[model samples]
Target chain A: MTRGRGFFPIIRSWSIAAVAALAVLAGPAAVPALAKDYSHIVIATEGAYPPYNMHAPDGKLIGFEIDLGNNLCARMHITCTWIAQDWDSMIPALNAGKFDAIMDGMSVTPQRLKVIDFSIPYTQSPTTFLVLKSSPLAKMPDTGKRVSLDDDAAMKAAIAAITPALKGKTVGVQVATIQYNLLHTYLRNVVTIRTYKTTEEHDLDLASDRIDAAIASTSYFVSTLNKPGGNQFVEVGPLFTGGLLGKGTGVGIRKSDPELVAMFNQAIEAAKKDGTIRALSLKWFKTDISPPN
Target chain B: MNTSNPFVLLGFGPNGWGASLVAGAAMTLAVSIAAYLVGLVFGGLAAWARIAGPRPARRLVGLYTTVFRGIPELLVIYLVYFGGSEALTSLGHLFGRSGFIGLDGFLAGTLAVGLIAGAYQTEALRGGFLAIPRGEIEAARAVGMGRLLMLRRVIAPRALRFALPGMGNVWQQVLKESALISVTGLSELMRAVNVASDSTRLPFDFGIAGFALYLVLTSFSGGVFRNAERSLARHERAR
Candidate 1:
């Protein structure tokens, strides 16, 4: 009889603990932390990459990716939460289960796809170089034209044009990025290569005279040049696309999260149809970088 | 939301990070041990320089300890991460080598944490050294004991006994400080939890789990060090 009486309280406490655990497992969607679910899911962004993502001086994340992510989330009935993660461990952190998905203008490259999955392309842009305006590469012909990597003649011409100026000079690129891979493959022996963890870091190093040139996305260069400190650098060399640059940037998700992928796909489609992607692209990049059809 | 799936994220399954977390904990221990040893060596040199060397040498050692101990730990980790590789490459360049000099994350993290730990350890060891009775050393000398013999028999044993508690504190400090190495991209326990949280989008879940793991590490180590102190003090009478 005493044992039976004691058992009730134990069972009651156990059930209470179990309920609390279940509530957390249900995620913010079941019981929205701040507002009604409205089928709205919160998306996370780094807010460090310019044009793709960046921070306003007032400490707000404002960039092309943030705009695109918000629009996509609105279409999918989800909210957005932009946060920063150190770029090197972003994949490891993604696999560890931090946020629902990453929409930091991460390119949909085959190499990156090995560890995680990506949504369909959202924005497409080619890689380019930004160097000191007085640098010889700035004198190269057709400075503003886009050139594909597959065009042998154009590729040779581009290589020939930049090689002499780049010879014995130091070039900076973000580590593990397509731009770094491109530099290493095409010009490793000819020039000194320095890889930084982020575009901003390389940008800082460039300003400090640590590197003669920096290679990144054209949109990124445009945004950087708009900033106060970036007035010294000018775009140089052919805009590199296809092969190694992979396709356009896309949303990244863990392989196990198929449901989340479906939800994001729906939202991305609605965003593209409504011209939200294009609008954000123009706002941040000053040009249309919406996924090329 | 099912309690039945409590083990889903923690279990050693393909989806779970249990294995990674365990490996990360092991890495943390490894880095801490390396850092503690490095601190021991650095502290010994520092104490020697301070107590036995010229006035200028002592001042320089004092400055090292002061600067390291005064600065915040996070800032120290950042300075080391960003600046360590550059410093190493410059050294390599002096040897006429070209190209980037790779300082693996683990080694760099260990060195940074160790260098910081050494500053605190130096003062502890010095206090221990100073506490040695002057009479005991004089007696050892009267008995025709050489400087080496006096240090081995009288100075070291007594100094170490007094220093045991202090050394234990330094060890604990080193263990805790290892967490800062995560920013260098070392996949230690904290970093593993970060990765898991980012991937799962369950910040609260992973953060709480990481907090629990750290508590366990500290508590377990606290017990071991307490036992060691007790054993070391067994021969001495209460003051």
Candidate 2:
């Protein structure tokens, strides 16, 4: 009788385990599968990227890209939900179907184009260096000038001019960003490059004097410079654009989703033509970053 | 107080993050409890298998515990977040469903933390069962008590008495592990603090707030476990 009773629980336990295993396997199917026709979409962004994207104190997402994305979604006549994702894994997560689209200030570049598709450029901002106001590098050469990296002679001269002030100094850039690639391509040998997970982290390091300089998009710096104690920092050196830095920021979608690419491209064109992008840029970034025709 | 004041920054004002922080703490608690229950299910099964199963079943449980315990918690989270979705998508394809099947952040975090906690839980429960005196089990057999009756009247209660302390440790570990789930983008306590600090550029204030919230959760749970242990010990003290 005891053996029989013992056998009952063993069978019960095994059956319970089997049932649980089946439930987990079936749970994903219960999620309504996506239809090919696009009606509802999910978009991912790095909420830590302020001005472009950041969470309001109320836990609401608000920023330049958030406004632009909503505008574009409305034009396309689709409902969208925004999800906050870490920047490093944004592309991989997009492909994995964690979200259908990415609007995280991701720029369009040749290397990125190889793995994913991007909409036509939406916002264009030049990359530059930021340094402490009291630092000698604050007076870096051609401080207010724009130098297109597509121009070989100008790019070479710009690098040469800044090398003296920057050489042997520690410079910070966000990891996996076009700005990191820019530093690697132009000044890797001259400076000790440090990478951070977020642009904000580099800003903190710069404020603490842990690094001599930090580099990022000028529009991003606009937010940094407006914050408390932001006056202690100043933009320096030539504003670099084009070439390896990519055309501008765009909506990143999976290579498998050409339809999404088309939808975003059309909506972006509408926003640009009607000056919605310009209005949002001026409101959030204090400057217009709408891509030119 | 000025805007720069820590109290003002953490207060429930228009610009303050007190409400969000509390919500995040609540999310952390929800995730921990769900994961702990999942761990108990898996751990109970594995422990039973180790105690009285065939050789191959024992070996399988052994492998499950070893692999989960050996990995870094973050890597385990990444695997469950990405790999769980990948596996589910493949399974969906087998049933003729197309497109990707993604696991949301909450589910992924729960599974990852549960699996890790399950490994430790298995050891604790097995130790509990083993610590049950063989003489008592034999005495139950001598009294003609059936296996189910013996388990209810003698075995389970005693084993639980031994397991309570170890299970409490597992519970605390699960609470801490829930913070790592932020990478999956579930806005738990740690992630909430991170976002608030980064957004406001005041890490110190938000950090302290987060630190206090975690302390309250852990200490509150610790007190509950202590009470449970004392209650479970009451009958023995009456002897």
Winning candidate number (DockQ): 2
Best by lDDT: 2
**Model 2: what TM-score for its first chain?**
0.90
lDDT (tens digit, per residue) of candidate 2 on A170-198: 99999999999999999999999999988
Tens-place lDDT digits, model 1, residues B1-239: 21224377776765666777777788788778877887888898999899899999999998999999999988877666556545644654575543223233455566678788889889989999999888988898999999898889888888988887899899889888999887765668887776665434454687777888888888888888889778768867564
lDDT of 2 by residue, B1-239 (tens): 22687777788997789988998999899889878988998999999999989999899999999999999999999999899878877776786766666666777788899999999999999999989999999999999999999989998899999999999999999999999999888889999999898877788889999999999999999999999999989978997
Q: Tell me the interface RMSD of every candidate, in Å.
A: 22.5, 8.9
Q: How big is the positional error of residue A54 in model 2, measured in Å on the Cα after superposition? A: 0.5
Model 2 CA lDDT for position A256: 76
lDDT of 1 by residue, A1-293 (tens): 00001100100111222234322321111110111223433345665577677544223467777767776766666555555556765665455333447887688888899998888888888888887776665675556667777777887787777788788989999887888888988899888999886687677667667788899988778777876556688887777887778788889987866677777777777777888888888887888888755
TM-scores vs. true structure, each candidate: 0.54, 0.93
DockQ of each: 0.03, 0.35
Off by over 4 Å in 1: A1-44, A57-59, B1-239
Query: Which residues of candidate 2, in runs, are more than 4 Å off?
Result: A1-32
